[model samples]
Target chain A: MRVLLAAAVVVTLITADLHFNKLSTARSLLDAAATPLYWLADLPARLGDWSEAQVQTRASLLEENERLHRESLVLQGRSLQMASLQAENVRLRALLNSSALVRDDVLVAELVGVSPDPARHQLLLNKGASDEVFVGQPLIDADGLLGQVVQVSASTSRALLITDATHSVPVQVNRNGVRAIAEGTGALGTLEIHHVAATTDIAVGDLLVTSGLGGRFPVGYPVAVVSEVERDPGQPFARIAARPSAALDRSRHVLLVFIADAQPKE
Target chain B: MDDSGYGYPVVLLTFLFAAVLAILPLPQWLMWGRPEWVALVLIYWVIALPQRVGIATALLLGIGLDVLEGAVLGQNAFSLTVVALLALVLYQRVRVYGLAQQAAIVFVLVGINQLICQWVQNLQGVGARSALFLLPAVSSALLWPVVLHLLRGLRRYYQVS
Candidate 1:
């Protein structure tokens, strides 16, 4: 009788969670309550980081600082050009009467934990709704687009990586602006572009970027680079695969993008 | 059964430790081999004290795990309730068995737990493509004796009756 009661409760909870948004508040509250568990679980990694910092050689640190200083000099030179280019682009947009583009703001969040299940490509970030991190917010790393926030609690949020089996992003080829949807293939390094015509201009080595059609991700962020293209006379659509630009498995810090127009109106 | 409930705190602490281990980050290759820590801990408690730890305790722990994993609220709850029921029914016979035989039973129990979780994930269309999801069951079975000894020591130390 107790087993049946527990089973019934499980069925009801699963149904409510799957079919309705009513459980989201409860879920967030649970996440908030479990915050300390995540912190405790992350203790080993934090200790490792602390020990590494403590054990780093002075000469090596100096060498790294020198390299960063040189890199920053080059980046500063580029930013000067970017400032003029941005002003020129704004003027061009005004002449064309197109809506002005607003710069996206980002908040850096450290990875607190990873999804324990290997099948799920999700990340737990230190930022949450309290940090104004909301569901559907796009995440990026230094190299390219990473993922999007899927769940937010008080001080922690979960983001689904673009390489997750269920995730898909709208992208365009940088070479020609041809649009395609890049679907995650459940592998960290690979994404599949489905339903492309065999005659399409896509080829191996084409750069895929966000097209901004979905309104979920900001425009023109690097997503992936085509790695393979297979065409067969018998099949109507070509098979294409790309490598994700972001270091999905390696990045320790990710940026949550806040676009001016992408905020939830609620 | 101990009506004083003096052992409940110790039981809760063990579960909390298992929860911590369950979410500890592991390298990519080791992820599939990560043992089902919470399930093993729940099984231990159920076997140790059937009266104090049963389906209700399993259900609550499973919900906590679901929250920790950001899974659908009841996914682990369903699987763990079934595990608790099986453990409760078999604990009498299991108490007299050798460690090897107990480990075998644990393999079966954790395997069933993995299957239920996989089934739930499959319904949501995010299930693993390979049978590697069952690898945790094997790892959990291999670690059963160690966990059993350590937890037994802790239980005896606390005089958990």
Candidate 2:
């Protein structure tokens, strides 16, 4: 009798969660309560980082600082050119009667935990609703798109990586502007582009970038580089695969992008 | 056998510790073989103190796990309730069984838990492509004796019953 009651409750909860999403508030409350568990799980990694910082040699630190100084000098020089280029682009857009592009704001978030189940490519981040992180916000690393925020609590959020089996992104070929959808193949390194014509101009090594057609991700962010294109005379569509540009397996910190228009109105 | 005094906190702490171990980051290669720590702990409590830890306790812990993993709210709850029911039914016989026999029963229980979770995941279109999802069951079975001993030690130290 108790088992029957529990089963009924489980069925109702699942149906409600899947259909109406009415339990999001309850989920967030549970997430807020569970934040300390995530922190506890992350303690070992944090301790390792702390010990490494404490044990670093002075000479090695000096050498790393010198390298960063030189790299910053080079970056400063490039930024000066970028400023002038941005001004020129805005002027051109004004002349063409097109709206000027707004730079996206990004919040840096540290990874707190990852999905325990290997089959799910989800990340738990340290930023959440308190940081104005909303569901569907795009996440990126230094290299490319990483994932999107799926659930947010008071101080923590969960993101599903682009390499998750259920995730797909709209992308265009950088070389030819041909559009296609890149679907995750449940592997960290491979994404599949389905339904391309056998005669399409896509080639191996072509860069793929977000086209912003879906309006979830910003335009022109590097997504992947085409790795293979198999065209067979027997099949009407070609089989293509690309490797994700983001360091999906290695990045410790990621950025949550906040587009001005996408932000909820106060 | 209604020794409710001081038993609740010890059981709750064990479950909390199990939750931490469940999400602790592991190397990619090792993740597939990671044991189901929470399920093992739940099984231990249900068997050792069936009156205190039954289907209701299982349902609540399962919900907490679902929240922690960001899974559908009732996915773990349903699976764990089933595990608790099986453990409850078999507790009498399991109490007198040898360690090897107990471990074999645990394998079947955790395997069923994994199957139900995978079925729910498949409905959501994110299920694993191969039988690798069952790897945790094997690993959990292998770790059963260790978990059993450690939890038993803790239970004795705290005089849980």
Candidate 3:
């Protein structure tokens, strides 16, 4: 009995991954069932957001206002100094406008849930295919590139974060424009730059951003900041590490960069 | 299988709940440390009602997890099948043990389950895992007593055969 059961187990492993192979219709039903559950699972966070907004009472608001006023005064003083360098910054932005890029139309989506599986770092967003969210759309946080949409549902979608061990993006050093592929180091705050030559002019603290080589992400979102550089005389590649831009845990909201033609071309 | 109290319908409902739990958007920080809720619940069923759940059930859930996780289709199904086998092995001997002993046995099974997950991940060529993942294994196992208690209560209170 056990032998047959074990054989059946092997068969289950082989055939069970329904894999959307013949279950296309079933997936839609699954998504339909998931929509209300997404809202339910997100209730705590939504309530948190609501209560947070509610918790800032008049007294705290006045205190916050006072602090903002003081901070604004200091920033105003700094603005005069920045005005002198404003032209150069604008010129850089203009220069970056073409070869490099920045986001234009973005929809901020609340991250509703995440896969707890350590192997895959993916997110469930409140936005879905119904919201014009499509595959290959760049998901980013305020800090940097998060991941792109891999699956779409009517009410929710899945995003693979950059820190997910499975993900890789082509990146360029902001300082020298030296391009290399940055792979997830399988940690939330870290990435590994693959095959940077020992002779490469890379340095610690150099900024790394998407190079748009894969054309999966945008031209140049700040992806990471190089944190370490390990050079071995015998090894041709320098072991380099960078901090990922998106700290997916700290914030509930992120921007999904929506483009007219969002599909990535080979 | 659909009894008024406990049966296939309840199992199906659990799958729906597990699927929702499986796909909920997690924040970046907590993403890696997330627990396999579907796996946990399914393991409970396998341990509780072996007749209803076994390799085939685990495989189906694994496939669902695969589509939900967006990995190669069979990756989780394969590992889950392995877990189902573990549950079957433990099912016989586990009943003889005390609650704590049963929980401890479950802990070992969870460890093996996590090990299988790591192995599957390695095979998939995406292997930057932390030891923190074992946290869920421990956590899910530790919860076994409570899960069994609640589920047993349901089985008794609802009076399903």
Candidate 4:
């Protein structure tokens, strides 16, 4: 009788969670309780990072500093050009009577841990609701699009990666302005573009950028590059696969993009 | 029953340690084979002290794990409760077995636990990539003997009920 009762309760909880998402608050509270455990578990990695920092030779440090200075100079020059380009873009939009593009605000967040489950591609970020992070906020690394925030707790948030099997991003071909949806294939290296016409002109090496169609991701971030384009005669649509643009497996720091419409006004 | 007063903390502290290990991140290649540390610990407690640790304890710990891993609520709880109950029922027989034989039973127990979790995930349309989801069960079973010996030592050292 006790076993039966426990099973019934488990079934009820599962049904409620799957259909209604009734346990999100409970999950968050539980997350709060488990935060210290996460911190403790992260100690080894943190210690390794600390020791690595401690052991860096002065010559190597000086070289790194010089490289950074050189990189910053190049970035500064590009930003000056970007300012002029933005002014020109605004003038052109005004001439065409189109709305100006919304500027994106970004917050730097450190990757504290990753989801232990292999089936899910998620990263736990150190910043959360206290930092005003909301669901569906876009995350990016230094190079390109990463993913978006999915679950937010008090002090942490989970961002789904673009390579998760269930995740899809709207992208446009940088060369020809052709649009397609790149769906993750449960593997980090590949994304599939289904249902494109075989006659479509998308070619290998074509760069893909976010289309910003669903208003989920901001427009014009690099997403992926076409790697394979197969035209199957038996199928009406061609199958295309692409490699992600960002260093999805390497980067440790990510930026959360807060768009104008997504943030609540103070 | 003299040590019953100290039993709860022993159970909780071991669980806390297991909780940390269960969610510790592994490299991409090794992640599939990461042991189910929390389940192994829970089974150990259920078999060692069935009167003190039972289905309720497993349920709570399972919920804690679900939240830790961001899995669906009650998924681990359901699997863990079933495993705990099975361990409790077989405690006498399992307690008498040699460590190797006991590990075989643990392999089956954790395999069942993994299968239940996989079933729940599939039901929600979140299919695992392949049969590799059972890899953790194998790894957990392999770890059982060591974990059991260590925990037994800790239990004796601490004089836990």
By TM-score, who's the top model here?
1
RMSD of each: 1.3, 1.6, 4.9, 1.8
Preferred candidate (TM-score higher): 2 or 3: 2
> Across residues B61-128, which tens digit of lDDT does each residue of candidate 1 receive?
99999999988789999999999999999999999999999999999999999999999888777898
Q: Which CAPRI tier for candidate 4?
A: medium
Give the number of the best model, judged by DockQ.
1
Q: Candidate 1 lDDT, tens digit per residue, A112-189?
A: 999988888999999988888999999999999999988889999889999999899999999999999999878779
Ten residues in sequence with the least summed lDDT for candidate 3 chain A? A16-25
Q: Score the docking of each candidate (DockQ).
A: 0.86, 0.85, 0.39, 0.72
Using alpha carbons, what is the TM-score of model 1?
0.97
Q: Pick the candidate with the highest lDDT.
A: 1
Complex DockQ, candidate 3: 0.39
Mind giving the per-residue lDDT tens digits that candidate 4 earns over B60-161? 887888888878888999999999999999999999999889999999999999999999887766668789999988999899989998999988888777
Off by over 4 Å in 2: B1-5
lDDT of 3 by residue, A165-198 (tens): 7788999999999999999866677899988889
| Residue A112 displacement in candidate 4 (angstroms) | 1.8
Q: What is each predicted model's overall lDDT from 0 to 1?
A: 0.93, 0.92, 0.73, 0.88
Query: Under CAPRI classification, how is model 1 graded?
Result: high
Count of backbone collisions within predicted model 3? 11
TM-score of each: 0.97, 0.96, 0.78, 0.96
- Per-residue error (Å), model 4, residue A204: 1.8
